[model samples]
Target: MRRKVMRTLAEARPDGLDPVPGGVRAPGRRRGSGWVAMVAVAVVVAAVVTVPRLWMDGRETTATAAGTLDVAAEAARRQVPLPEGNYWSVTTLISAEESAGRYRVTVTSKTERFLPRDPAGFQLLAMTGLHTRPLTAKDAAAWRAAGSPRLCGDDTDCENDVSPVGRHRYTAMPSLWPLDDSGLTLPLSRLVELPVEPAALRERLLALWPAYQERMKDWPPAPKGAALPTRDTWLWSLSLDLLATPVSGGTRAALYQMLEDLPGVRGLGRVTDAGGRPGAAIAMGGEQLVVSEETGQVLARQDAAASGRVVNAVLFQGAKWVGKLPRLPKGCPKVPVRDTDCVG
Candidate 1:
């Protein structure tokens, strides 16, 4: 079940001189009385100024602490659980910049669902490289040696050679993204042991929002009133698992530590979601995470600003998550076989 939380600020009133009573002249005051009144007024003014400053400082500290705790608690809530059955997820990426090009990528992940295979199933596996730059000659040669077809000429030619309709659609390929290795889990696990500092965390969150939106432009726009979640939305959710240390109260402390230690933290500001809930955005290094106010769940995550190069983003819903992969479907068949067999 999803829960929503909202933050609201209250207005403050300034206390100072009351209107002079009915414009009546004060009864003549003795000289001593005048000095006493002046002293009293000075004291009041000092209290007014100093008290507010102290109060403001206290409030700021409290806000920072509260925000940090809230983040950590939310992270604990979303930590990945040991699977009782097989799990699967798919992710998609659309460029946020118009000049980048018109292509999106999608990826799918799968794990075993039961015991005996638990070790392998418990292992996290991911597919990558589909949206990456075209393969190199060495990469192609390795694929060929592994039974993949040889390219007619170059990478482009090699891609054409593997065209599914005109050729065989093999069940597997050695050149596919590596899903068999242990990934960044260790580095991520280490991130959740630091401290909680919301101001710094907020800044990091805001930095990633633009990076995600910038890439959104590359995706075909969603239907009106529909906006896709940012890449950070997903990363934040995944990071929750790393934060789930038993000693850290399951995962909350782990998450707090991760947020505190996130390097090059930047904020992306408040993102307005179509669902009418305020969303927080952030980026850590190349990864991004967006958190929803309504669900308190991360909606998206991906490498949005990694050297302005190809990166993967994952989207999640409950236990389901998707990874973005790059694979173009075969173009329409040519009526007359010619040099230009494909059309854009």
Candidate 2:
């Protein structure tokens, strides 16, 4: 299930690794925080897996879905055109997590390998997840006085004397986001297959929203008048996922179409990103997103502050699909399927 963002994005993810391990933690295992190292890795699947969607509530939502469809229809009707070329886009996904008056920055650069057998599934390869502790004069002085000496997780050069003393390092993790496409799954492939037509996409999204909502148990069900559980956040979450995942141009465009319905999301016109490239812009939930006018790919998302500091940012360095998995490391230990040894 997805977690809360920082009331901000980290409000979305504390360690920003909820899609993988439970929580980001200090190097070396904690006694009882349920910290895990590697998540489930992917192996080639030749046949198409037909799995039934599992609903945690177990109650049917066909009627409730009708309400969702109405929301989608409204969203679909208002979409503005934004086109993006089809190709695999490699990205450097970066986030600065705030805690205890310090920002723990995590940088992860990865290229995705789209599986033909599983159009919706992609293998994240050449992955690099690193953490940096940039300290201020006061913070450095405090750590130094505290004996700036503890070594960081494996890399000695990385001194453990950092401000936010509890951040973890996730490196070279090769795994699926939802872990797999099994029972009660997120319907990523199914959603991808839905025609780019906004109305059609909305239909499919509502069909899947119940299952998707089950996964987001961290948030309560939409009450009489709660904010995020509204149609906007529901569709916004799906649209955000598609933009971040390795999907098709049709899918990208369809989401932008639905996004047009979000009254909360305001287009800020053209803007340049931190990387100095021009793209269209929009804002929601105190976060602004700069999307490529051509590809519909999200360039960056940051706080709504005038300074516009980034909460999370992504730069699509490159993109394209490959026929086969990139490769495995030489003699990479083949742990048991359920083993927790693989370092992500």
Candidate 3:
């Protein structure tokens, strides 16, 4: 789903407008040359959420029963040493919930992106695996009681099959780096150049609003005349997106500090991410980010509905600069060119 990042630029825009859409596209990029996007689903049930044990220097320190964790300090302690490599590789597990007749199912996917250091070098994407299952055990039981009918019977066969569960893999085409969007854009190489100071980063991000607003007018499906969001909303959304990016640990810390200063940003106590990792949840402008209490890494970002149901989430698994791209598994579908659309 990372490819959907470019499909809609209104990510986390206020007023409950669905920010990200389906599928990401790069200008002049060929079809199936997977692009990354920023949308997934979060299953955050507060009642079952528990305060996590604090970790210090790789040791268990104390249990924070209060459920409150110092986000900025933890972020500052994050030690993501930039690896010596020729490509920036990012991996994420994305999940989203969709209605299936009377029941809802959660679809999850694992994606890896390899952006070459040289701008002209080919960028690779791989959807390592995907799975769709009932949103909860209750839903599964209900589906079974209903005889496990395929929701899209005779249509597309409902992702995998209609029953227990299954995982699917797909091959992706290679693409070029430096996203070609009409609005604000940041090339892979520029990620390291981001300001590490909170104030300066705020100023830097604010400078892009005019261009972003101008471009939104041309974004397809936008009404002839529609009001754009305020600077606060835009900044909040951008910060969220950038946090999930391969920004430096220092920059990520600065972002956490910036979010702390932003209005309406508040702690949501402890919450578990889609990956079952406990994190300190923070909320701002109708969106939530679950951050690691120890490493300060962004564990997940959630968009919830009015009823407090997490509709979508994007979970950060790991990211680093690598010396080379991952090799395609044996028996992958190969195209005529260098890249292959091989499913693993």
Worst window of 10 by summed lDDT in candidate 1: 1-10
Residue 299 local lDDT, model 1: 52
Provide TM-scores for the models: 0.32, 0.53, 0.66
lDDT to native, each model: 0.31, 0.40, 0.55
Tally clashing residue pairs in candidate 3. 14
Q: Which digits, one per residue and each the tens of the lDDT, describe model 3 over residues 211-302? A: 87777767576457544565776677667657645677778878877876776566677788767899887765336678887787778777
Task: In angstroms, give how far residue 268 of model 2 lies from its true place.
Answer: 2.1
Query: TM-score-based ranking, best first?
Result: 3, 2, 1
Worst 10 residues of 3 by lDDT: 47-56
What C-alpha lDDT does candidate 1 achieve relative to the native structure?
0.31
**Which residue runs does candidate 1 get wrong by more than 4 Å?**
1-72, 75-83, 88-117, 121-253, 261-263, 267-269, 272-278, 303-312, 317-344
lDDT-best of 2 and 3: 3
**How well is each residue in 1-344 modelled by candidate 1, as lDDT tens digits?**
11001100111111222246435434432112222223222222221111001111111111121243355346545555433222232222221110101221121221110111122222222221122221445544444454443212111223422212133221121111121111222222233333334444445444545655666678897899655753443334334432222212334433444553444445554553222335665544444455564444555443443342323333443333123221323663311112212212
Counting clashing residue pairs in each candidate, in order, gives: 45, 19, 14
lDDT digits (tens) for residues 113-155 of candidate 2: 3322243433333333344342346655544554543323212
